[model samples]
Target: MTFKHSIKTALGGLHSNTSRSILTILGIVIGITAIMLVLSLGAGAQNLILSQIQGMGSKTIVTVPGRQPSGPSDFANVFLDSLKERDLQSIRNKANVPFAEDVMPVVFGSVRLSYQNETYQSTVLGGGSAESNNVMSDIFDIYPEQGSFFTASDVLSKASVAVIGDKIREKLFGDIDPIGKKVRVKDKTFQVIGVLGRKGQVSFFNFDDMILVPYTTAGQYLLGRKYFDRIIVSAVSEETIRTTVNDIEMTLRANHGITDPEKDDFFVETQADLADRLKTITTALTLFLSGVAGISLFVGGVGIMNIMLVSVTERTREIGLRKAVGATNSDILTQFLFEAVLLTSLGGLIGITLGSSLSFIISFIISKFALASWSFSFPYLGAGLGLLVSAFVGLVFGLYPARKASQKAPIDALRYE
Candidate 1:
């Protein structure tokens, strides 16, 4: 009888039933804290959506405006009035393919900007040329801490000139200096030349609550019409992203006259198809929350097989005084399989430290805004898969109650009572 005296007589029979070994290790500590808080909140929401899609410029390529998928009101009538400007001059005559510098055409809405009396509603867009502010300075890398971003003759003279963003210059010039201020917006005004810089935020896109303007004052006085919902191109390198997406899909399928390419309406997409659609939606939500944390480790291995069948019916006279003192049958089946693998490896090390502190409090509420930074270590591959599957589910449910308390015997367990 030695594997350290059968683990100090199976931890002195679990400290003489300390509240039934803490209620049979509360289902392996709630199935290893719900599979380590669903694999650390699905690997911190796919590392904060691949760091906000590589901070919005993963070799950018977007295009939108694709309808007739047969429904959803054909993507709301291709978002009303289906994309135009000769399909943005068939993406600027596929600007002779390869490393085709920039290409624009955006169009957007949501108004109410104001100033004196500080209004703030937001979102305004418009853009195009001044190489769409170098594709919004490589998708919000930065530029304009306060003035100047419009020119391609200020979008060919529709100039009311604008650029604002750092949260609409702190809700209309707070720390003052919003260039040569003027604000207003749909009701017309404008002027605040520039102020972007601080670009933070992605999912729920808040590159500092926008404003921009220009594409001819969003096609004459805020969307009077002249359609365009998306288009932002940009290549200049990355080895001419597949010959600039096959010359902007063969110059928008020969300027929308569409000689087939699935009846071309428009709809490109790249960055390796947005990182395989966000790693197939974070690997199907981390295998559906690790199959609901493997049903709480299969209900904590059926509560360690019903407390090792009520510890072989309350230790029949201590297995007949350890088989009348000679102690054999593999030392009472290794003291009830080392007291059900030391109570499910101390309930899988306190459910991997309370599931890695609930995936670091949901990655500190999404790193307050710069997105993704969720952590989850303690994965010695989930602590060697919770110590070899909670000690092989306590040696297969304490092996038929430790082989029925080592095959009964020393005279029917000293005539069990």
Candidate 2:
């Protein structure tokens, strides 16, 4: 029989047992759907994280306290109080780090901010120097929409002045002007000097929800800590990033009195290194989830094999009739094989539609209610892979049943009930 004739016959057979065919490929549909959804969500999350990281610009470098974490158990390194005022001074000195264009020492803590009858709990960021405004403006492109950032005198004198984010301004002052108004931070009243423009989440950190103050004020009166949590450095140019990072490492090592690089109490990371690390982490997580979803496909393949075996047994007389005429064994085999492939291929199509729809809905919900940065993405590769895997599954599982049906003797099959 011709290939087209076999396909027609196989489809007719499937149509005749519509309910059974649907049941047989149910697992395949579910498996494909899972694979597509997992891939879509993974891609969306990776894009959100990477976009935030990229917003910091390519020439930026971050220096964090504590030894670099080598394993999960070393996560405590993040909380270590290793960076101090002297360390910040060393990094800011042009003689020590000539390539460094800007530096900002940062320390943050949760605080209760209150104005009049309003009270809200929010994170307060302490910036070490007045140049922090320049760093934020130049590298992050963040500037105050109202008033301006605090001056160098404010930081040096540990002045109780604050720059509030858009969200904070809305919650505390509402329509009233917040500039020159006083807001209490940890029992000390600070004059609101500026209001920052809306800057959304960056690398999972919500800048819009936090208040900015001088690191001196925060360390002295708010957080009651002398050490900085992190130090941000911007290179003069992209080419100077490596040199700046090296200078920072050298400066910190000298201050901490560390002779060996392995024993250094701090870690410095460039923007490129951070981006690569995030990509690797997200890719590994996506693959692991995909592998888990593949189990359903394996189960579906087994189901296809079992159903095909049963189909062959039930159609023994029909096979005998076809062979009794001029139909060859190859013709009978191809017909059965096509039936199996058709079922799985149909399942794959259905799964692609369902998975894509579900992914869209999930993405929409997340973006609307959670992070606005969350986005919906089409899983084109996942859809293509699902279809290919479905076809391959049918081919592998249907072979035995098709061979069995083709091998049945005409006399024996004709005599069977």
Candidate 3:
């Protein structure tokens, strides 16, 4: 039989039992759908993470108050009081770190902020002199929409000044002007010196919901700790970042009286290092999830094989009659194989459509409500792979049933049913 004739015969047989044909391909549809969803969502998540990391700037480096964590058991080291006033002073000295351009000690905690009867629970970021605030503004590409950032004098005197986010202002002050107002931060009252713009997120921080204050005041009054959680350092240029990181490391090691590199209390990470680490993590997670989704495809292939075998048995009489009417074994084989491949390929197309639609809807919901930075991503490679895999499953699974049908003796098959 011609290839076209075989395809026509295969299609006609499937049409005779449309319901069964649809049921037979359901497994393929589901498997492909799962794969596409996983791949599209994974790509979107990776993009969002990378974009946020970029907001920190390539010339930036951070020093955390602990050794690099090797496992969950060592994670507590991250909260240690290793970065103190002495370390901060040493890092700021140009002689000690010639390439360093800016440094800010950071501390943060959750607090209930109130304006008279109005109250809201939010995070308070304690860091920055006015110069450092400007550095932050430049780095994040956001500035106060109303009023101004706290002055350098604010840090020196531990002044009761606070810069609130847009959400903080809305929740506490309503439509009233927030600048120059007094708000209670934990036990102390602070004057609202500035209000940041509606920047949704930057470097994984939701600036729209945070409050900023001088680290001195935050340490002495709010968290009641002299040590900082981390120190943010900026290099004069991107090219100097490596030298600056080395300089900062040497300075800190000497200041802490650390003679051995492995015994160092603090850890430093540049933006490139952080980006690479996060990318590796995201890539690994995506691959793991994709592997889990792949199990569905294997299950679907088994289902197809089982159903095809049942189909061969049910059509035994038809196979025998075709063989009795001048049909060769090769012709019968081609028809059955064509049916299997067509069913799976059709199911694959349907699955790609359904998965893409669902992924887009989910991406929209997440971007609109949860995170503005999130975006929809289409997995072209995944769609192509899904189609090819579905077709391959049909070929492998349908072979046994096709061979069984073709090898049937005409006289035996004709009399059996």
Q: Rate the local accuracy (lDDT) of all candidates.
A: 0.74, 0.88, 0.86
The alpha-carbon deviation from the true structure for residue 345 of candidate 1, after best TM-score superposition, in angstroms, is 7.2
For candidate 1, lDDT tens digit of each residue in 114-229? 88887878788787575444656655465777666887777877888888778778767778888887877868888887888776665335657878777767777976878877
Error of model 3, residue 365, in angstroms: 1.2
Q: What overall lDDT, based on C-alpha atoms, would model 1 receive against the true structure?
A: 0.74
Error of 3 at 232 (Å): 0.9
RMSD of each: 14.5, 1.8, 1.9
Tens digits of lDDT, candidate 3, 241-291: 989889888998898889998877888998788878888887888778877
Off by over 4 Å in 3: 76-79, 130-133
lDDT of 2 by residue, 258-332 (tens): 899988888999878888888999999988998898899889989999988998999999999999997899999
Residue-level error in angstroms, candidate 2, position 5: 2.0
By TM-score, the best candidate is 2
State which candidate has the highest lDDT. Answer: 2
- TM per candidate comes to 0.41, 0.95, 0.94
The 10 consecutive residues of candidate 1 with the worst lDDT sum are: 370-379
Candidate 3 lDDT trough over 10 residues, lowest sum: 130-139
How many clashes in each structure? 1, 0, 0
